[model samples]
Target: MAERIFKYVVLGGGIAGGYAAREFAKQGVKPGELAIISNEAVAPYERPTLSKGYLLPDSPPRLPGFHVCVGSGGERLLPEWYVEKGIELILKTEIVKADLTSKTLTSAAGETFKYQILIIATGSNVIKLSDFGAQGADSKNILYLRDIVDADLLVETIKQKKNGKVVIVGGGYIGLELSAAINLNNLDVTMVYPEPWCMPRLFTAGIAAFYEGYYANKGIKIIKGTVAVAFTADSNGEVKDVKLKDGRTLEADIVVVGVGGRPLTALFKGQVEEEKGGIKTDAFFQTSVSGVYAVGDVATFPMKIYDELRRVEHVDHARKSAEHAVKAIFASELGETIDAYDYLPYFYSRSFNLSWQFYGDNVGDTVLFGDNNPASDKPKFGSYWIKDGKVVGVFLEGGTAEENKAIANVARIQPSVESSDALAKAGLSFACKI
Candidate 1:
């Protein structure tokens, strides 16, 4: 077996991996001291664009344009940047086995990798219908977007099946974004979910109502409180019909499932301590095992602001956590100290001339404010979540950059709220003042 060694190695080439590499370079690293190993054939690029701009019908976004850092408004790191920095980019290599005790990683190939310090950023894998024993779940054209390869496949399918019928399974980010993307291709799109509203984990009924109405206006059908139980494929094994639990079958040329995802941590199952379905880490993102750090979707680290341990799967946290982990690593080497990660949970999505941003917890009572009419020419609205007499969360649709920043601050600061009625009446002004 081939053997290689590096002082620092980052696993998984998703958003976290890319951001970690950028941070390592920024913090000063020897040319050959750091290496990133990824099973993806291409270098790490922004994963969010796969569902957003990449699926657009227009001159859609292509790679090299959306590489790391750019998504967060930083300098883009092209494939050549790694070469220039002498940082090894090991692509198309999957590490099948991890031995934390020996500090070694075994790839699917016969190669072995040894590292003094390792960063686990394996990210998450999509939950598939087949995992639930759904019939014909393996049919062709039933795609899930997670990586560049999946995005490319979907793009090609969109071209070949222009104006075709599409059934979106799952009501989360992927379902909403993909429905809009396929609709833009002039395709007939239908969304199916087990929940009564889309993004049930986050979007309240009022917030979902506007989006559902907006989607209806765009001629996208939505089927709520039901799920796809089976998929029927044509002679060529392409999905042709979706059978739902409610005894409804919708004709479909393509099916996309986005139910949810779980962190990729099976390789290190018994090797490290885990929590919240992810590797457990402290404020510094250092796992129980020394010289090992976990970040991004795979790290269930301490959420200082919430005074708890939690795992955030959003892109913003992925970027920030990766940078913070690298900073902590360097600081530890110098026997220095840095502040703990105090993330104020942030999430956002954009589709069909509508964009929204949310920050902080979604729990507690919610107050919807502003214009949310689906048919309105220009609708600007927001909601505030008040918990324990404090504004713990904020969501705003059609917000300017400055307004979005204001809401984010409100979430971080969690200003006091005297009365829900007055807070709703105050609306955007309350956030702006805070």
Candidate 2:
């Protein structure tokens, strides 16, 4: 069996892994000292673009285009970038076993890797219908998106089934975004979910109203309070229809399921401490085991700002946490100290010339503001989550870059409000003034 050694190893080449590699280079690493092991054939690229621009019917983005750092407005890191930095890109290698005590990782190909410090950025896997015993879930053209391979397959199927009837199961980020993406392809799109509204974890009813309305305006059909209980396939073994729990069957040439994701933590399950379905980490992204760190979707780190432990799966946290982990590691080696990670949760999405950004937590009473009319010539709207008379969270749609920054500032500052009605009346001005 082949064996390799490195001063640092980042497992999983996704957004976090790419950003971590960039940080390592920035902090100055010796050639051949660092390596990134990934199961993907390509180096790490922006994963979010998979469900967004990559699915666009016209002039879709292809890789080398949406690579790391570029997603965050920094220099794009191509596969050649790793070659230039002398950082090994162990592509198409899946590590099936990880021994924290031995500081070793074993790949499915029987290769072994040893590292002084390990960054666990394995990220998450999609929740599949087959996991729930949905009949015929394995039928062709029934898809879920989590990685580049999955995205590529979806794109290929979209072409093979042009202008197909698509039944999307789930109303969260992936489902909503995928619906819009498939719709843009001129496909007949219908969304089905168990919840009364979309993005129940984040979007309030008032917030969901605008999107549901807008989707309706775009000719997208939505069936709420129901879910796909099973699937039926044609003789060719391709999914032809979706069977709903509500005794309704919908003709579907294609089906996309995006219920949720589970962090990939099985490799280190018994070797490390885990919480909230992820590896527990300190503010610096250091795991319970020294020399082993976890970031991105697989990390449940302390939220210094909220004074609690939390796992953030978004790309923003992934980028920031990975950078923070590398900086902490370098500081510790130099016998220096750095402040704990103080993260202000941020999330955003874009589709059909519409964009929205949310910052901070999404708890407490919410006040919706601005023109949310889906039919408006220019629909601009926002919502604020107030707790203890202070703004704890803010969501804004159709916000300019400057306006988005202002709302983010408000979320971070959590400015106090005298009255909910007054604050609503003040609207975007309240955030702009702050």
Candidate 3:
């Protein structure tokens, strides 16, 4: 009698899928026994740098050049890693359908794979502004940046324009970063947001207001509480202006729509349970079907802080969640139950010469800690969200190594009246006083 080898099939080669595949290899899974199917022709690569480094005009002109360079060996997350790890790499392959009851997946190439385990890590796709009719009005000037291809096209378009005025249509992290980069390139930039402050969904009103002044001082116009109704273009078919809901029109050359993105789960539609644009998964990241798991932006699970189920799309969430999913799979194979995944969510962004970091969940009743400077003259201070005397979240500006570590430690412990007093004694100021 010989040990039976199990087959594992993973779909999507983005961060979640790529890391999952690598983790499987490290778990002693042989190459022939595991297979990675992706529609992308190239192997997995880092996407965070796409909007910053890879999108710059000085970057190499080809797609391959966008691939990150690693040590002296110049090693990247190339497909050869799959071969070396004994994993089968199926590039330029799309999974069209999956028969969950039979544990079978059908690819666009007309090949079927039956696996004992399946992982779906399909990332997300940018929500196009065309859906809102803003596309037809200035089809030539409106652009969306999601992947390397989108960045490349945008770089080329920017290079051809003179006296370029770029209007970014969102106030999220990506949009803010893009705005900063465009301003750094010395182009006229304006950001339009439907909310009263930027990143309101991620941070508190106090923190969001802080960034408004931070960006305004950097020569980037912040059009808060305004929305674009339509794009007005010149007869030559180039974007000339943007008409806002306020009956005002502003000049623009390029309109970069960074409104947000939706998870790429169309292939799993009707086959898996989804809520609010992500697959509904258990604490272990298992879907409704047996042996099928989902992670990253496409999966939603319970959050300890909010005491509700939520989907997080940050890089840290994806990496941490996928690691939990892998461990659960390993445990289940041995007929053992694993503990539920419970880790605090963390995220950070760098823009306009400021580094912002947040830990824990920023939801629920919060009492801010630190200075509240609306004038934006001094360096912005950090704020901690207090709930029932425990610090649930911390948001800070100007990345001080000591302050960040202190915030991290405070976030892990329950804040009591005594602990709060201790923090104040430890030199953490209250927002109301400042």
Candidate 4:
């Protein structure tokens, strides 16, 4: 058979690939000129929803509703959008071999395709307990959430294990969010993490205190200073309990692991430079090799704000970097230039009717602001990170639109703070003024 050809091909059909394809379409696309290779059966939808509203039984967002661009508050790009734009979407296909030198990709079935330009957006893979040689790690009902299929499995398992005991292994966003989802389902939930506080990467102790306490009030058990070392399975090959590193065991009808993730960059190994465990790229998301780019969780690019190389694994970067990569491709073709991506790192999570938004880096001395009493009827809290005598980051819980926007602006501007105490005293008002 003849080899398939495309002017441009985007690998990995998650948020990054979807957004990149949208950008390509926006610029212009002739029939069969562009294609998106995704292992997912459906077109790209907001992946974060897998843990949030998608878990809700009532009116959960299904496919086509939460497609790409919707997360950016722009026009949703459904599967039909691809057809309308004359863009080919190769779904349920996995490229087993990639040859950067020849600009060729071979599918798992041995079909070959060639591209003039390529964008890599494979994202990441969940770090499984199996990687650590945990006993009974492959037991049934022990789940993870990374893609729609995983979410579907979790939802199905929730029904089969309704009102059951759930042991959440890890206290990051995945564990925290899933805790709420399972708890709301009336399942008994226990969270175990080996960190001093939850979200140690972003939330300071003071910041984490509010959430930990809030979760406590929600009737979820919190176990810190330890991790799930092994799992116990029942006669039916379903997870029955979790053994902790601290020599404690807890009954678990369902186990969900969210320890962390490793960037998916094995396919392009040795083809391009790698750093920070991700494919190295410039501010424009162009990889070390010309006509090839990497984005999303797999792209480690320069952060001009911090004057360092950083690889961010959040949805915001996933969407922005994809757009940037496509824009950079179009620019190169048209002999035009655009400003580099100056991203102010942002992350957020929502659980149990409580939401938080954070902006900029979470480094330096953190100052807590607002009341953090989980018992309070109206709980509102935030934190600011002051680094180099400037407010480098802002975190606010239960912020309104204008209020959230204020914190974002503060993070982007990084206003100087005379002192941590003074900044704490200024609080939300200080951010509002900015």
Q: Write the per-residue lDDT of candidate 3 for residues 65-165, one digit (tens) a residue.
A: 43323311234556667788888777788788878887877777677778898888888888876767664554586888876667767877777774589
Clashing pairs in 4: none
Q: Give the higher-TM-score candidate: 1 or 3.
A: 1
lDDT of 4: 0.91
- Tell me the TM-score of model 4: 0.98
- Residue range with the least summed lDDT across 10 consecutive positions in model 4: 56-65
Output the number of the lDDT-best candidate.
Answer: 2
Residue 104 displacement (Å), model 4: 0.4
Per-prediction TM-score: 0.99, 0.99, 0.87, 0.98
> 1-434, model 2: which lDDT tens digit per residue?
86899999999999999999999999998899999999999989999999999999899999889989899999899989999999999999999999999999999989999999999999999999999999999999999999888999999999999888999999999999999999999999999999999999999999999999999999999999988999999999999989999999999999999999999999998888899889999989998899999999999988987899999889999999999999999999999999999999999999887899999999999999999999987899999999999999999999999999999999998899999999999999999999
Q: Which of the predicted structures, 1 or 4, would earn the higher lDDT when compared with the native?
A: 1
In model 4, what is the error at residue 71, expressed in angstroms? 1.4
Residue 151, model 3: Cα distance from true site in angstroms = 1.6
lDDT agreement with native, every candidate:
0.93, 0.94, 0.74, 0.91
Candidate 4 C-alpha error for residue 113, in Å: 0.9
Question: Which stretches of model 4 miss by more than 4 angstroms?
Answer: none
Error of 4 at 81 (Å): 1.4
Indicate the worst ten consecutive residues by lDDT in candidate 3: 65-74
Put down candidate 1 lDDT per residue, 19-50, tens digits, no spaces. Answer: 99988998899999998999999888999999
Q: lDDT, candidate 4, residue 409?
A: 98
